[model samples]
Target chain A: MNEADILAVIRDELARLAPEIAFETLDPALDLREQVDLDSMDFLNLLTALHQRLGVDIPDADAAKLASLASLVAYLARKGAAPPP
Target chain B: MPSLGADMEAGALVEWLVKPGQAVKRGDIVAVVETQKGAIEIEIFEAGTVERLLAEPGATVPVGAPLAMIRTEGEPAQAQAIPPPVDRPPPAAPTLAPAAPPSVTHPSPAGRVRISPAARRLAAERGLDLAALTGTGPGGAIQLADLPAAPPAAPAAAPFDFSQMRAAIAAAMSRSKHEIPHYYLSDTVEITAARDWLAAANAERPPETRLLMGALFVKATALAARAYPEFNGFFENGAFRPSAAVHVGMAIALRGGGLAAPAIHDTADLSLETLMAQMRDLVGRVRAGRFRSSEIADPTLTVSSLGDRGVEALFGVIYPPQVAIVGFGKVVERPWVVDGAIGPRPVVGLTLAADHRVSDGHRGALFLAEVGRRLQTPESL
Candidate 1:
């Protein structure tokens, strides 16, 4: 999928985890855990959701690198998580 | 209404999942009640048919008040009269008197009146007759206080709002600190083995079925509790009653503000895969504001974790009735001595806050050590 599409998918999953988080006010560079106050379980669920939706496997070792919104979208793009054409 | 937690004095009935005349077996979710901890699905322990609904959907009822009447097996089908809702006073200090006045008359005394010295002095000073007063103390003993006329019972109702939840938490924690003589001990245990084992296990499993370090900590704690019964029970009425089963309460922080530690029943018997699934389901249901009454009520001991994003360690306050609480902190790399060689290893901070009345520091130390030892071999858990 495109960068914007991947970003949208991430936002949707994040919203499901924390409905109170406002995506418009969320800074893409900020740590998602601090921004949304999500614990480890919530983060794991987010990754699982993204993996199911984008068909990209995010191993636990790479979890630290995708802590921010911008990094997560970029990583999904790098992983070639393209929708079936 | 059932006592969802120690601090839950009252709850508002949100909805009834079962209707009158509906047949229900034991462990059926009967209704939903909104407490300070959010909506809890009330479960019925009796196998019976619903005779009548006592409380309305929006009525705020005190704990132990009748919500419904059930006709058990082999009972006549005769219609039973619905009892009126119990008028309970608002939650207050234990020193406060009950709203209902004690009956003035008593049965003929077989022996001398059992009155406290202080009460005797107070009665003589006040020119009051001790024979006319009823003693509410232990074994009909009169205490040193004048019995005032019973006041009007006030409804212990509060809005089912978030701030009220904060108030409930404040009440519970305050009660815990005031009542429980807490002794805290901290130990940093190496979890490299557990981490490695989890990684290898998860590498072959699907993401949905993969295990987390939390499940291991819970299992270890449960097993250690089984070995050391002192740390797994409730201290009530000046006695410690040990539980036969280890139902570990996992503290879940709510998104809005407060937290709830609901029990994962029979944690010691659950496999790692099953424990992880149950943990995930519990967290999801807690966030969704739906959990069973027994989950909220039947925790023999509590296990709290700050998660990987939190501080190095936390010493939790023992939730009252329960004698102990075990806390797990974020796992971080720290220099350690392994085979007399210093190297970096993944270790997590473990803390135990136990009631001094139930167990001393020596036994508490052994319990913590046992937990650490169990964590060292996660495969057994």
Candidate 2:
């Protein structure tokens, strides 16, 4: 799968995970937590889902890379679709 | 793998604690695994049936390696791909404690008596003894307020944005301060006896295991709480629910982040040495960021001490649910006359913030006075 496809999948997955939050109305520029009240657990769940779906090794330290969709998408592009084995 | 410790690598199928085809609830420990860290029990997060045990006990494989497949109550599990096996003996379980499941045991969230490292360093640089100031952090771990008086340095040219963590803290604290009905109480204590006994106690123990002032205070607090159960319980759902356990919350200030109060469960049950060891382990793990999620959750009551800081007195904000939060100020040389002669003696200031809706100031004062009386006869410890 291409990077864009993977990014779309991640964004869709996050939206599905948190139906209570207005994920569709989220501005690409705002902080994720401020926009959706995503606590630390929610952040971990997002990373866990991405890890399972994409086989990506999202280290706990690199959790900061998920601050915004653009950063997240950019990170996936840099890391690529098939995660490091 | 880039790490040496328990990263997702090199797992061993220690044992199948549950039988195949058995129904298991979410968070049920299905199997045990011996990893480099120790024997960690694998828990299922979703309710399901143990459809199959793919790997036998004593088999070794890299992590993300499946050992068993569980079929959800109604749904079938997808086919799991088996990766190549690594030629290694079943890893031996280390002597260390097993990896506690995050769901089962969250990190203890008793706020440390707020004393920050920067504050400690600043106080030290200014030749200030920290034991004089009252902490304002959770459980009263020393924060910047506990720092000795020093000239303010020039502000940095570029201001830094509040980190997400800090922003969350600001919101939570603001909510706590605004929403919680708070009441304050203060008292003074003579610690002359405790000080002398403490010095002797330190002389006996190894440097690594020396008792800190916080440890002494914790023991004393536990003793006093036994006398005054009302101070230890919380006012919840239009009633006061007293905790059966004397879990003392010691507020600790994280190095560069917000404060957390990790509770010492059943403080009255633990010996001084055991308490100190637990505190040491807690401090080390907290600094290393290895705290389990649950450890940072619910705590009954909190204590905030800045006795190490040079400040004379301060009030602490009451963490919700808990009716009272105790603040400890520095022990200072006070001029008091004894036997018709004026002399300098070490004294402490304590401030207790209670929810007045449940506890009146008079009741709070009585509790503070009881704590003060305990400190005078430190030999009881």
Native interface contact recovery, all models: 0.20, 0.00
Count of clashes in candidate 1: 2
Kindly list the per-residue Cα lDDT of model 2 for residues B300-349, writing each as its tens digit: 67887764444878798765556778888867879877799988887788
Query: What are the runs in model 1 whose C-alpha is more than 4 Å off?
Result: A83-85, B78-160
**In order, how many clashes per candidate?**
2, 47
Superposition error at A20 for model 2 (Å): 40
Candidate 1 local lDDT, B45-128, one digit each (tens): 777789999888777887767788888878878544322221222233422221221112112222355554335433543456
Error of 2 at A54 (Å): 50
Number of the top TM-score candidate:
1
> Would candidate 2 be rated incorrect, acceptable, medium or high by CAPRI criteria?
incorrect
The TM-score, computed over Cα atoms with residue i paired to residue i, of candidate 1 is 0.81
Q: Tell me the whole-model lDDT of each prediction, alpha carbons only.
A: 0.77, 0.58
lDDT of 2: 0.58
> Tens-digit lDDT track for model 1 on A1-85?
8999998777777776776667779898999889889888898888887777788877766776888988988998999886544
Best by lDDT: 1
Q: Put down candidate 2 lDDT per residue, A1-85, tens digits, no spaces.
A: 6767876666655653344454568877667655665533345456655765676665544655578876776676677556436
